[model samples]
Target: MSLLFKELDYRPTPIGVLSLRRRRELSLDIDVYEIKLDDEYLMSSLFTDAEIALADLGLADLAGDSLDVVVGGLGLGYTAKAALDNPKTGKLTVLDTLPEVIEWHQQGLLPLGEQLSGDRRCELVHADFFGASLSDIAGMNPQRPDTRHDAILLDVDHSPGNVLHDDHKRLYTKDGLQKLATHLVPGGVFALWSTELPEPWFEENLAAAFDDIRAEVITFRHPLIDREDINTVYIARKAS
Candidate 1:
């Protein structure tokens, strides 16, 4: 591998080939880390405004300290770090279906791995977030089964319409959302990150199970294109 680019690790997962890589950006004089699923780039360290915003916007909706939060994806640990950064956050449970991703953090392979894993407030767990969302008994934290949280931030799929797996499609529906709501404390916040623009139909589905729904568009500079790009963060709160 060239000094500018290196493939750190690769593993075959049920969904696809999971890989972690690091590359040097001479133009910016910075090191960039990336996670990939086969040919598709799952996440990059350079662009994480939306991921951070997912946690910010979600936790911002709630009022109180010692907030119990659950993040539905591990990715590059951007969202998890953001949640832990908030002083209001007390305990954070991060759930991901892939054990490799969770191991990357525990082994300190990723950039934010050490920061997230070292924090006593954060717990990285190997679990299917989508499956837990629809489950009333298991909830987001399998160890603390049936326990509700103050905030639930999700960034697993690309978008409500464009899901990574067919099984994830159910969680986007009104019925699926209603089931997810049961996992949250009353008046708790639920936020989601999407690469595409927010759709009205999805907002309608969220409304069925939540109140004070808001679709926030987060704009950030695209590192590759050197132009503005946008991602959506959907925030909703369960009825009190």
Candidate 2:
């Protein structure tokens, strides 16, 4: 007999209802963990190549033996987990606007939560990535107020023009880009995962704010759809 578990966890978040579900796939004969916001599916364990690539592509050029990094958003823990997997990453700070999401990681409600929570190098912080001011982040670290991380991996919103919340749209602007650049060390990199490819205005904005910039398309096969879909990762290197 095929076994299935129906202990789906759902909680009301400020934005909407957040849910975490784990169930057995009859045909696949495996467990799949999924997260949803109201009626919209946020993420699933079934696909994580691009999420891992966000960290991989961002920190590709970092030559140092030890690096301090920050990741915005803790969706399925794939990005943070990828950063931890890097031998060069000395410290990792993950920020998420949703407290319920953080609680899921701490409570071991997800597959990778126990491992991520147990890692001494990883710090899961509850903060708004875009809304935070210099002083606010300085509060997270008294010494380094201006530049803190070697890389900042962001997967918070849909894209530059598209956002998950009203307040998050500002981060896509030139002014917002300037604030994020201050967090990276000299020659640091910023990578953003987007459901759509880079828009012209957004690409121009990044070029104006940073040095070299690249937009990559990640194509993957989706069995459910029986077709291939495309996602994008925008990478920009901060001026040294």
Highest lDDT: give the candidate number: 1
lDDT of each: 0.92, 0.82
Per-residue accuracy of model 1 over 108-154 as CA lDDT, tens digit each: 88888999999999999999898888876845899999678999999
Stretches off by above 4 angstroms in model 1 are: none
Q: What local lDDT score does residue 51 receive in model 2, on the 0 to 100 scale? A: 95
- Please give the lDDT score for candidate 2: 0.82
TM-score for candidate 1: 0.97
Clashes of each: 0, 0
Mark the regions of model 2 whose C-alpha exceeds 4 Å error after superposition. Answer: 1-7, 133-147
